[model samples]
Target: MTDFDIPSFLKTLSQRAGVYRMFDADNHLLYVGKARNLKNRVSSYFRARGLNAKTVALVSAIHHIEVTITGSEVEALLLEQTLIKEHRPPFNILLKDDKSYPWLHLSDHEFPLLAYRRGRRGGTGGKFFGPYPNSGAVREALNQLQRLFLLRSCEDSYFQHRSRPCLQYEIRRCSAPCVGLVSREAYQRDIQHTEMFLNGQSQQLITVLQDEMLDASSRLEFERAGELRDRIETLRLVQEKQRVYGTDRNMDIWALVEFQGVTCIHRLVFRDGRLLNSKNYYPDNLAGEEDPLLLLGYISQFYLAGHAAEGLPAEIIADIDSDEMTIVLDALRQQFDRSILHSRGVRGEPRQWRAMAEENARVGAQTRISGHQESLRKLERVSQLLGLDKAPRRIECFDISHAGGEATYASCVVYSEQGIASQRYRRFRIRDVAAGDDYAALEQAVERHLIRMQEASDLPDLLLIDGGQGQVGRIQQVLERLSITTVHLWGISKGETRKTGWEFLWAAGARQPIIPDAHDDGFRLLQLVRDEAHRFAISGHRKERSRSRGQSDLENLKGIGPKRRRALLLHFGSLKNMRGAPREEFAKVPGVSQKLADQIFAQLHGEDRSV
Candidate 1:
């Protein structure tokens, strides 16, 4: 490989608006950015005196630079964001959790259920009500609406399997839609009211509820009348509390704060004059750019990348102001093709909202810094306890999950000095392994994980096994076979009671276990990591199992598609009901041919007969 010829390359550089990419010696992208003047922007990195430490580091690693010219600066800006999201270079401001925004889905069915979803990947029909900021916000909104409307929230699979209502109906959160207690018409009425609430027609809904309550009372249905009256009163109380926020606007408030290099941005979301949900975003700014441009880049990337749940609310209140911001606003206006009204200047409630955002960001940063310090101290103690040369910066724990030897999954959870790096967590489906053979499953998972990390050249400092000396031995064998010596491996085994805080730690070739006190911070951290691995594995396994179970019974039969299965199930009510039925009955269902019906009958009912 040859070093980057900066002087020679700069000779032919153009001065047009475009996006530029910087690559290191291995042809790995190091950073990507947009430039109004490509020549000037690219040359600034090579300048001798003005670059910061991070920029200088980036420039030093550069082996090549690539530029893509665009028609205009706006196109260049959009292209820059797209590349950043796709490549995620080290020097760029990376947004963690770049997954699609969460939404509240109302299904279209006999008794529709309200569900929180992150993406539109499910094979079901539904109406989406949000691109909410985060999962927590979506769940909170769904829970609140379910409480008011008593609509079902269970998955269709669970609903289908339920012989009776589960705990949710007993708790009055669901009106037993899975069972026959709730009529389709009644559920539709509840859905309509829920839609009104989501659509910001709260007062109209209250009026409708009041009228229903009076009608029920006139009909001498006191129980029904009382329920409607309570709903009306609760909605009225909510309206009273929401009166402070005028019913004329929906907006998102952005506040950015930097504390000792730790930057936190707090976003407050409001809709229909009511506070909906808020979230704190902590971006990784490795290049260390600090200016109003930081806030601008964040907002631009958020909406342009489709991270904003509601996609540019009617109004946006940001904490920073600058002439440079107009560049982004105009780009946004051109991209979204709307009058993007923006202002840093605020009065009254909006000013308070911005202030609150700032305060939240400040507090969030302080807490994070404090928490990081405490984590370091805990790591220091762990270093001393383990007699290691230094504290481990990145630790990973592995676990295995299965139920009766089916759908086995091995999970690896990562914890860094900063905190739990959940985005780096991974799950591996264990295949071709014997039933309940956790030892082999774990060994296989560790082998795969180590090989990948080796190729990526990003091995963890410490490896934790969620088992005793036996698991540690298997993993050690994997490392020895792979010749990986830098990673420190240890095992944690549950006590005889198999409870938390009773864990025995085992190191490689160690005869005795190190059983630390429950209050030890390092030990507590291990417990947390182990628990997270267990949780991740179990959740992934359960989802896979549920998905497999949801497949049609006729899926394995010949000549049966989704439509055929639907028709068969609908006509027979269920596969069980068709057990003793003749092939002629199956052939009568739509989309079922006589020959195929005979085949299905033979496979499903162990009998074959001509239709």
Candidate 2:
């Protein structure tokens, strides 16, 4: 066993009974485990049989470890799960699906019925049978519930105010509870039966339905008997579709696959004793590794960062069993304060579930890799068409906008190898330029951007303008005058009919036009960048134009300085209303004295006024 120093910071704790945590150089939690005796369990890592290559590597980078004392093994286990979920250490097997489970919510009323719900509970009362894997499964169960129970599914407000049965009643989907077509006692009986059906008491429900149908038939209630018969048939069909039948336990089966330098984690969720949804996750850049270790890391990180334990299931089944697995289960138990079984199976149904999940993960990783390859190919093609030194890994596009020269603004949008670099995008208001002069606006925008970049030493590799030769020429002249030599600039000219795909590219000092291949990937890439810049510019321009318009309206009012004008506009929501207000309302403006208010009101209304 290789001995390593426990950090001086963590050495003071009582190491009697509890779980300990290990973290790597990046401060990512690598592993978490508990022991009956902390000193013994932790010291085992330094013993002759203590370390493997992976653990040795992990220990070398061990920056820190933390420990907590628990009264019992159960307590330790529980605490372990809680911390694993919270910290999401890198060396535990993680189930990465974070999607909220869909649920079938039954409204509590005279005629309680089913509806699909997500997130926290806010709907009126009834039992919820979920977190189902997806909404489709919830819908399917809901449809069957409606057909079988004949409960009203309308909104409570609408149901209370209704004077007559709606279309659902006509179609026999609802029992017209809103209109008193069904007695409360009968409705309660139906609700009870629906509960039983969802609780995996299908056989009991079938028996009860059969007896009801016989009784209805004997009493010459043929319509009631036919309805009962239809409901029985629906229940029978639903039963046939049930994949797994237990006592209504919800569980999630998780599996991890490491292949071809990628790692994918798959989750199969079971709700109401039936398989409801399957999810696949491909964690980024985890290729070429031992499968078990990768699986362990994924499990720890994923659950810590996911909603799995918060949505606490009865059981969790997985393929790999390691010391880290025990630590994770313990952590989850502690966090939720519930005994959740973590099971491992070498054969049988559990194995099959694990296999399915792993296969799904592999497929998901393959799909992601393929999509990324295509994106890179398209970017490369774009670079070739533009005759760039290399693929424009970092492209900056610009657009200028103004409302007939008011509030002139320009925006720069950035795109990198990973797509839109929104954080790097910037907007500029053309200050030293005359209104409605596109050339001046373009030059001002270019100069502002270049000066900032020069000061900060952060310039883009490529510059794209959203106009033809004129705007492009202006930008080029500005760059030359400023002696900015590092960046390449080009202009995107709109097509002949002002449509896409027919645009031309204009570069500085080039007499020949560069027309990109219409069907080329490079063209598509450039188009996306150009369109995004235009969108951003237009949006900024609209905001500035609105502000200028508001200022103009305020200027029309007499004796309204910046402070008072801003106050009035804020209070009134718009300048027109501020201008139209009575003297009494104007007096309420934060800074307006009574004399000023009266004068302002009279001036706005065209009465004898004073300023």
Candidate 3:
């Protein structure tokens, strides 16, 4: 393997465009690359002169090389991604967030449920409105949809058991169907309006609503007319705010910013004239790559990934154009069952979208570089202290949090040289673990995280857990079970005094804790990772706790199902106010019959009296 004949292999390669794979001494895939001319590309690596450091290292490690000829350069580019994904070679620039972004799903139930879904598409048949820029955008969209259409956002179980209209009904954000306050026919109509609004058919909806409003007014139904007028106005305002990016084209704009070999990609999504959402990506190991190749690789992974394939736009605008655009367009058309356009230059909204993406990419690059430089220094010190091969570029830290053994959560926060890799941060809802069992929770989180990494080369170079030796032992057992031995695992724990300055670093097989100086950069870096994991876990736990507490309180009130519970909460704004509200106020709620209101009042008062 050491005496591998590169010259002979280069001589045998054809000039045809294709993909090339480089393997190390043990036949492990070191890199997967593509080129327009297989012979020239392969020979370039074996050139007697003008080789960069990265290429030199790659060439030096190459024990064997393989190539697959393609019909065209575009085919080569497409094949390259397939090989990279299949082999997950260490040298390729990988998409860090392997999972898909969140999408807003409209369920197919009788009363549709609007939900923020991530990962796999639900088996339940319905329409998905987005692969939004981020979860925040999805949430915002869901909120807007609820406000606009007043559709029920509750689960089936809750909807089925509803005794009366919920808070959403009281707040005019839902047409209560739970207790027959709103008929199926009317609720179905609202669902249609919601679909139209989300699908960018707001103009049509406004026209219909306007007609209804006038009809209601002419029929002397002033109250109904006013409601229709308000709905039409809301639709108009939303449409006005979202200025169309393109006159007729739906486009996805991608731009890149590179600093010191690190690259940041900005994606701007515009649909039906409106800028839907924008997001930024930090792909690793992109230094020395040409703009065309880099952009091509990104688009391949971006759209090929399941989450991204949804709601495909008709056109794509990139800051850089390449020979691969035609291939990408072809692939996208086949994937989405519609032709897609690719443009490197454009005017109007597309140009604006690219400008926005470029600006963000530049800012993101600056942030990435500054953070990466600072982190490298810290990582170097950490590597030396921990006696590692080299600096740790990727570090993952885990922490567990619970509210009195309820609503437990485990958070894994990632820290690369580029500071906080928030996109890679994962939060696990601890379902199987017993309440308050931090060890079990940590073990479960570590197990699941490792299992996902089993087939991927993107495993972190270092691992940190927020606890003492016991927690470290639990994680060690998980690694052992998973047969992962290369990852460096350590535990950060508050020392004897339970204070910041006296923190203990417990590593595997270490006889005693290694305490770095308080001011040491490595220790500070560790603190950053540990603190982030703790904060993330605590936040998740708090959210879960709040939801559970809210649901529990409402569920305990006799005859107060999801709908009635919602109505009371909306009208009163809180449990305290709901308990204090006069029984007559409850009766005024849309779905609350006088008898139901009396029962609610009696139940609430009885509990207060008993307490």
Candidate 4:
């Protein structure tokens, strides 16, 4: 199927509302669109004079066109958005930003308090706040609320375990509810005030504080009056910093900008009748197609894809009103079963606000373009410095670790052009090696890794080892034994000062040290790979060593088999606890008979000791 074929498919579409998708020859979706009249809208794309050069190019490669009929325009819009998000259609306006928004969570306990939270899941009791643009804003708002209402911020664990009022009480940041320093009824009053502040009733809190301050002063309670005055002053300061952009209590202003074939969209969020924050995102690449219809398409997918929906506003303000807008708003209404307002401003400050959002989007797009270009340059340089056949697309590094020749382990880390390939990273516990023999450990790791690679038919473009000539030699031997001649291997040696730049590279069969070009991009790439390998190895080593330490006490149990020793360790959690346990407690452990328990107790406490 070719460009001409798309027009034929378009002709078959009905005049009714629905969603349409364009796919390239490779079956990858190129675009997704919602149309009020699918037949009329889709037919326009095939018209020679109607389509732009980019659309023509897109149409030329199109091998498939699929459509889904919906009950209403709104359903079509929602479907289009969801499809675009899931497939990330190349020609569709993408939301580009997918970061989880922060929320203020209030614990659901009897003494529920507000706290800042990221992502969806956390402990049970608490009310959550805004997926505020940043953590600082969340913290600032939390601090102000705490100071004004003197609510407890301590975790349940700390609250349950506390023996005294603690520092929060002394500092006046908390009412010490945990230790009964404040009665439950009084604490509940503070909690109610805090909730009021969160609900945007700050003025009421200020009034109450003012009355309390005056009463305290009148009753000759100067310290109490001073505290209330400080709290009132803090609340005022918070309000002073909160600049309101508009009177609209809840709305989102979306702006789209296109530059150098990249699209950046910015969302200015207003919560509780105040401008809260703005979120910016840059699309992958649009290939120079700039139009309001595209922006409208982006908005539908942006909101519908579950990026910034939790705090969805009552209305969405956009620069243009396309048929897609009706579809998007309809889908949102269906989702929440609440009427949502969608409008375009032709005059007044609303139009100005829309223009500002568009401008922000443009700036964001430009910034993203610059950042991408810079990253590309860096990656290219990294490829060159490593003296790679072509910059190594997939590099794997290995490291070995052992504690005094006990519990030897190795870890292999992988990196690709995109970034670290965490799924490919692997760990190995070295076997058939003497304790404390670094050379044997390295050989065992390389051989095991190569055997697995041979079986899987998965070989990395480059292999890196964490040590000097000795590690290099071991890897070389393993490769030679396996007859794997095609893979490139190198060993990195640390500098005399154990610093970064002092790295030495040893490649198989090379007499001279094959040092990476100091200023070359390949060198930087190698350094990153080397550092990552070292980090992976060290982390694996530490974990293995810790496990070995926990198992050391098992070595003292002469009569215990491997399975029984494992059972003991698993039941007790650690060797220290197992060693310190009384005979009666040992007897209670599963799989431990009375005789074994007695033997363990006598061994731990000495034979003369009584149970």
Whose lDDT is higher: candidate 1's or candidate 2's?
1
Each prediction's Cα RMSD?
22.9, 23.6, 21.6, 23.0
Please report the candidate that would top lDDT against the real structure: 1
Tens digit per residue, CA lDDT, model 4, 519-568 = 45456556666765665665566667657677454664658888787556
- lDDT (10s digit) by residue, model 3, range 1-611: 37664443453355545567788989788987778667688888877799999888888888876554433343354446545655578877753235465666788787788888884464758887644434665676677678767778888889899887788888887778777887788888888877777676766655566667668888999998876665544343233222222245677878887643357887766556544444568876536577668878888778867546337778888955556788877787788678887777555445545654674565455444445455577689788877789998889999999967999999999877656676688999988777788899888888888889777767888999999888898888888888888899999999889877689999976668998887566776787679779878877777787698774455665577787776554344456555544344566555787667757765654311110
lDDT against the true structure, each candidate: 0.71, 0.65, 0.69, 0.64
What value does the lDDT take at residue 233 in candidate 2?
53
User: lDDT score, residue 208, model 1?
Assistant: 62
Give the alpha carbon lDDT tens digit for every residue of 290-333 in model 1. 74668888988888777876567777788567576677778778
lDDT of candidate 2 over 495-531, digit per residue (tens):
6888777889888867766877665657766776787
lDDT (Cα) of model 4: 0.64
lDDT of 2: 0.65
Flag regions of model 1 displaced more than 4 Å.
1-372, 551-611
Cα shift from native, residue 547, model 2 (Å):
4.9
In candidate 4, stretches whose alpha carbon ends up further than 4 angstroms from where it belongs are 1-393, 402-406, 545-611
